[model samples]
Structure formats: C-alpha cells, structure tokens
Target: MLNLVDSRSVIKIIPYELIMDTVNEHSCHRPKPTVVTISDLLATTNNDDLRFALLYDPPSVVLHQCGGSGCCQSKSETCTHSEHEELFLEIAYLSDPDYVKKTYLLAWNHTACKCAAKNNNRVL
Candidate 1:
C-alpha cells in the first residue's frame, strides 16, 4: 500500500499516457482534444486553473485519424500514436511546476520499491 504522502504526491501526476492508451483501445473513434473547452467548462472546480495549465492541445491527428472521423479518410493519413504519446507526456509533465518535485520523489520511491522487490525475488 502506498503511504499517504506518496499516494497524495502520485495523485498529482495524472497518468495521461494510460488515459490515451485506454481511449485508443476502447473508443470507436479517436478522442477529441477538448482540453481548452473542458477547462472552460469546469472553470468552477477547485483545480480548474491547474487543470487548464495541464490541459494539452489535443494532437491534430492520431493514428491517421484527424480531429474528426471523416477528415482522416479524405486525407488518406493516420494519426501518429507515438507522437501523440510523446506530446501528451510532455504536456502532462509540464502542467504543474510545483508538482514536479513531488513527482520526482514519488518516482524515485517507486523505483526503489521495484528494485527492492526484484532483489528480494532474486534472493528467494
């Protein structure tokens, strides 16, 4: 179980890559880039400003798919999932300056735990 501090810190880091992956896998159509509009829509939330800061400009295309369905077919192009992943990771990481420290610490802890687990398994 993650400790309170660790859990809280990790929560600050949104797993945007995972989200994108899930969207890609499940959605019949590509997810829309509505971060700006979403931020506008949720302006009342406590972290609305932060959310907006974290909001990434949805990639123009993913897997050859354009912003909309019919567009990609006409262009005979596909969205680049790898590029989208990179962009999303960049945006997510860039969103919160303050959270950066916490994220790093959390990552270090996770690595340490994984390493320790690996060592224990080897011993066993």
Candidate 2:
C-alpha cells in the first residue's frame, strides 16, 4: 500500500520546468542553411572539362556512383562538408564576399551518394 501511494505521488509531480525548458529550446529560431548556386560552382573552377561537364552533361555522368569504400567509412554514409580555408577562398569570389558559402565537392544526401569523379573536379 505504501509503495503504490509513493509511486502515485511521484507520477503526479511532473517536472514542468524541464518540459518548459525543452519547449523553449525547440522554439528558438535557427539560422538558415548555406547552399551554393550552380552559377557559383561553375564560376569557381578554371578547368574547361569540368566547366563543360557541369554545363552540358547530366548529373549522373558528372558524379561517381554510390556504395564505394568511402561511403561505408562515413558516419552518415554521406560525405560531409570539409572546412578548407584555401578552397573556401577559391570559391568565395564567385559568391557574395560578405557571406560566402562553405566549399565542398560532396553533396549530402541520405539515399544518394554521387559526388565529383575526382578531386580535381571540385564540384559542389
């Protein structure tokens, strides 16, 4: 009888403060995610083959197929954006100087894992 009463009492005193804090945390505004435009990607590289491939070829031909060793090694099975300052600066000139998007060859997609064929391509 005493155990049941204590259990009931414990259940009745719900932690309202924790609930409110969680609600507030979820409600707080988050900044928008950065994305690069096709034009921006095109303008960054001087390689004629890459420029032509991006402009003329379909995405299927431009990117490598999924299920590679790299895919298996990655945490999300997707290659995340790398923070390379030199690469960032190279691509930064194509976009707004004040708000430059981070440079990345790999695109983040759960179902699909198609990225540039080689390191030299440098397509985002």
Candidate 3:
C-alpha cells in the first residue's frame, strides 16, 4: 500500500492493483513487461506525449541495464548523468523487483553507481 501525503499531512492510500494496472509481476532478473500499447508508442510522435510516455510509463523501459558505460562511469566517479541520459526503467527494475511490479513511478538513483536500494527522484 502507498500513502500519498500532502503538505498538510493528509494521507491518501493508493491501492496496489490500481498502481500496478500497467505492469506485471514476474520472476526476478527477468525482463519487466510493459502494458503500454503500440498505439501509445505511436502517439509519442509529439514531444508532450513522448515525455509522458518516457517519464510516466515508457514501453521501452525494460530488459536494459547500465554496464558502467557512459555517464554511469564518470570522471567524478559518481553516478551522474550530466552528459548522457541515465537509464531509467531498466535500473528501476533492477533495484526493486517487488516495487517495480507495483508501479511505473520508479526512479533511478543519481548518486549510486549500481542499482540503488532506496528510491530517488532522479530520472532520465
């Protein structure tokens, strides 16, 4: 169960099924499945829909992981994506299999070189 807390501390509980409507739970280390339809991918011809699809529920956010190439390996030695777009959904699935199965609201960690154990606001 997820509880959304507002500024006033008003809590709203979101059901698991509602949040996971677009994802499927599978074996760990397997590719995460996307429910985003082909029509949804086609609609991303425009920037707005593309942004929505990439950020909210990207159909391409699966089966990929950073190999410490690109920004995952920086001169600063931190997991910074200043020069490249960080792999978002792939790392999310790697970080938390259980949580990733529940929502597409997954985020990548900018501070951790490997898949992070905790959630962060950073994304591509």
The TM-score measured for candidate 2 stands at: 0.20
In candidate 2, position 44 carries an lDDT of 58
Q: Candidate 3, overall lDDT?
A: 0.34
Model 2, runs deviating above 4 Å: 1-31, 54-124
Model 1 quality (TM-score) = 0.18
Better of 1 and 3 by lDDT: 3
Report RMSD for candidate 1.
22.0
| Candidate 1 per-residue lDDT over residues 16-50, each given as its tens digit | 78666755564323434322333332345465444
Instruction: Kindly list the per-residue Cα lDDT of model 2 for residues 6-120, writing each as its tens digit.
Output: 6346334447786666655533122123444445446656755444442321222122222231332223433322222223222222233344333334232223333233443
Model 1 Cα displacement at 65 (Å)? 23
Identify the candidate with maximal lDDT.
2
Taking the candidates one at a time, how many backbone clashes does each contain? 7, 0, 0
Candidate 2 displacement at residue 90 in angstroms: 18
Q: For candidate 3, lDDT tens digit of each residue in 1-124?
A: 5677777896878787965552333212222222334233335345443333333323443322232322322243323232222332321222233334223333332322332222431333
Q: Using alpha carbons, what is the TM-score of model 3?
A: 0.18
Error of 3 at 65 (Å): 11
Q: Tell me, what's the RMSD of every candidate? A: 22.0, 16.0, 17.9
- The lDDT per prediction is 0.31, 0.34, 0.34
